[model samples]
Target: MIRARVGARDAMRILTEVARANGQIFEALGVSKSSVSRKAASDQFLSRSESERILGLAKLIGQVQSMTNDAEADAPAWLATWMAEPVPALGGERPINLIGTMEGQTVVSNMLGHVLRGGFA
Candidate 1:
C-alpha cells in the first residue's frame, strides 16, 4: 500500500534521514546504506515489506513531532531518544527494538495514541 504512494528513492531518503538524525548507521534498519544508494540509482522500488516498515517509521516520527510541538528539524532527536529509551508500558523494552515488526509497530502506535489523548503511554 505504501509502495503505491511512495517511490523507492523517497522511502530511502526518509529512512536515511531518520537514521542520521538518530545518530545511527543505516544498517540499523537491516539494509546497508550502499544498498539504498544502489536502489535509488537504479530507480528500483522497495519491497512491499520494506515499504511498510519505512511508512511505519515515518508515521511514528510524525506523531512524535506533533506531540512535542517541535519543528520538523527537532523531531529526529526526540524520536531517537523516545525509541531508544525503555518504556514502562512495554515491559521495559526499548521502542526501537520492537519497531521492526508489524505487531510491534501497532503497539507503539497505540501507545502514542494514548499519550496524545493525555493517557499514560
Candidate 2:
C-alpha cells in the first residue's frame, strides 16, 4: 500500500487525472464523469462499494505508474488506502468523506504534477 499524505483536492485531482488518463476506460466501463458528478452532488457517488472500487482502481493505476516514471511518484499511498479503511465514526455520514483532501492542497499539486506528466508513476 502507498504510504503518504493525500488530501481532498489531491484525491479529486487524482480521480480527475485517472479519468483523463483512462477516460476511455471509464467511458467503456460506463463510469461517466457526468454520472460521477451527479452522484457526488446528490451524495450518491463514492459509496463504500464505489469508494472501494475507485480506490482499487486508483491503487492499480498507482502501482502501474509506480513501475514507470510518468509522474506523481511522490503521491501518498495513504490517500488510496484511506478509501479502503472503514470509518465507523462516520456512521450515517458521507460514505466517502474527503474533508481531509480539501485541507491538503499540496496533494492537488502532486496530482497536477501527474496529470501534467500524464498517468500515474
Candidate 3:
C-alpha cells in the first residue's frame, strides 16, 4: 500500500527521526549526516535517487512496525533489532547490510511481506 507523496523536507525529517530512534546514523542509509542536515535546513528537494532511498527506508520501517505490532514507543527498537540481525531467508545476511541499494531494499521489503503473511524467513 502506497502512502501520499512526502516532500523532501518531510522525508528528511522522517529519516532523521527513524535513524535516531533506531540508534543508527545517517550513513547507514547511504547518506551523510551533513547532507541530511543541510537538506533539512533548506527548501530544495532531494534528487530522484535520494528521494527513492528515503521512500524505501520509510516503507521498510512501516513494514517493521506492522510485523511487530508493537507500541509506537517500542517500534523503532524492534525495527533496529530486525535490521541488525541475520535472516535465514536472506542467506543469513543482516537486513541493514542490504539496505544501501534499491535492489537490496526491494528484496528486504519482499521478505518482510512474506514474513507478514506468516511465512518463515
Candidate 4:
C-alpha cells in the first residue's frame, strides 16, 4: 500500500543488490535521491508515482533474473552487466536506460520473451 511505504526501501535495496544500481537508476525511474533520503530519514513514505516506479524496477529485475536461469551466486553481477549492455532491438539503447517507464519495461519484457522463444533480442 502506498500509504504505508513498505515497498520503497525494499525495492531500492533490490535494485542495489541485483544491478549494482544507484541514484541514476532511481532518478530514471522518477525517484530523486534527495527525496528518497529525506523520506527515509523521516521514516515517511514515497509518493505514489515514486513507489510505483520503484516497485516496477523491482519487478523488472525479477523478470530479467528469471530469464537468465543463472546460478544464484552469479545473478547480481550478471544482471548488472546485462542491464548495461546495449541491444540492437532497442535502437542500441541499454536496457537499463529504458526500464524507467512502463512502455520501456513492456518493450524490454517483450524482448526477453522473444529471446526465450528462440527469437533474436
Candidate 5:
C-alpha cells in the first residue's frame, strides 16, 4: 500500500465488503467521492494517505474476524452491525463514530481488545 498506490477498486472493495459502508465512508476518511470516482474511471490508484485509511479500516475489520475465529464466517457481517452499536466503554458512542481518525481507530481497537479480554472486569 505504501509502496505502490492502492487501487481505487481495492479501496472500494474494502469499504463495501469489509467495512460494509457507503460512499460517505470516504468522506469520513477525508477522501473525496469525486476524487475516487475520477480515479476509478481512469483506473488509477488512490493517494498514499487515502490508501492508508482504507487499509486501516480493513485491518480493524480483520481484527474482529481474527478475534472471533471467523465465527462461522460471519465475523465481517457481525462487525458491520457491531460497529454501529453503542458501547459503554466509549461513553455510549458507536464504534463506527471513532473510526474516522487514526487515534480514534486505536481507541476502537483497544475497546475490542477489552471485549476480547472479557470486558476488563
Candidate 6:
C-alpha cells in the first residue's frame, strides 16, 4: 500500500528515483535519518514547509530522470537552471502537515505506481 497520500506519495517516489540517479536526497536535502524515519512513520504529520521540501526534492529527482533519458542532457547543468527558476512556495498556508507516516511499503507502492504509469511527468 502507498505510504503517503496521492501527491506526497508521488513526490516520495520521485525522490527515491532521484537518489538512484544522482545521490541520496536525504543527504542532499540535509534530511537526517531521524527526519526520514519520522516522515516514514505514517503517523507523524509533516509541516507544509516540510512537504514543500519533499516536493522540491521530488521535482529535482524527476528532472534527473528526464536528463538521463537524453544522452546529451546535462543533469547538473539543468539542475542549476531549475534552481535558478522561480518556484512559488506551495502549501505554505497554515499547518499543512498530515498525520500519516510514509514507510518502506508505502514507498514501494508509490514506486509501483510510477512504474505502471510511466514515471512521474
Cα lDDT of model 6 by residue, 26-76, tens digit: 454444546555565665544554565665544444545563576666554
TM-score of each: 0.78, 0.37, 0.75, 0.74, 0.80, 0.36
**Model 1 lDDT per residue over 40-120, tens place:** 888987777777777888888788777777564566666776677778888988778777777888898887778666887
Native-vs-model 4 lDDT? 0.65
- Rank the models by lDDT, top first: 5, 1, 3, 4, 6, 2
Q: What is the lDDT of residue 24 in candidate 2?
A: 38
The candidate, 4 or 5, that scores higher on TM-score is: 5
Off by over 4 Å in 3: 1-8, 65-76
Cα lDDT tens digits for candidate 5, 1-121: 6568789877767766634533346556777777877788889999887877777788877888888774577655666666777898788898777777888888888888788657841
Tens digit of per-residue lDDT, candidate 3, span 76-95: 55566677878998999988
Q: In terms of lDDT, which candidate is strongest? A: 5
The TM-score of candidate 4 is 0.74
**Pairs in steric clash, model 4:** none
CA lDDT scores, all candidates in order = 0.72, 0.42, 0.72, 0.65, 0.73, 0.43
Tens digit of lDDT per residue, candidate 2, span 4-49?
3233333355567544433333332234456566665654434343
Model 5: residues >4 Å from true position, as ranges? 18-24
Query: What TM value does model 5 have?
Result: 0.80
TM-score for candidate 6: 0.36
Error of 1 at 62 (Å): 1.7
Model 5 RMSD in Å is: 2.6
Candidate 5, residue 100: the lDDT equals 78
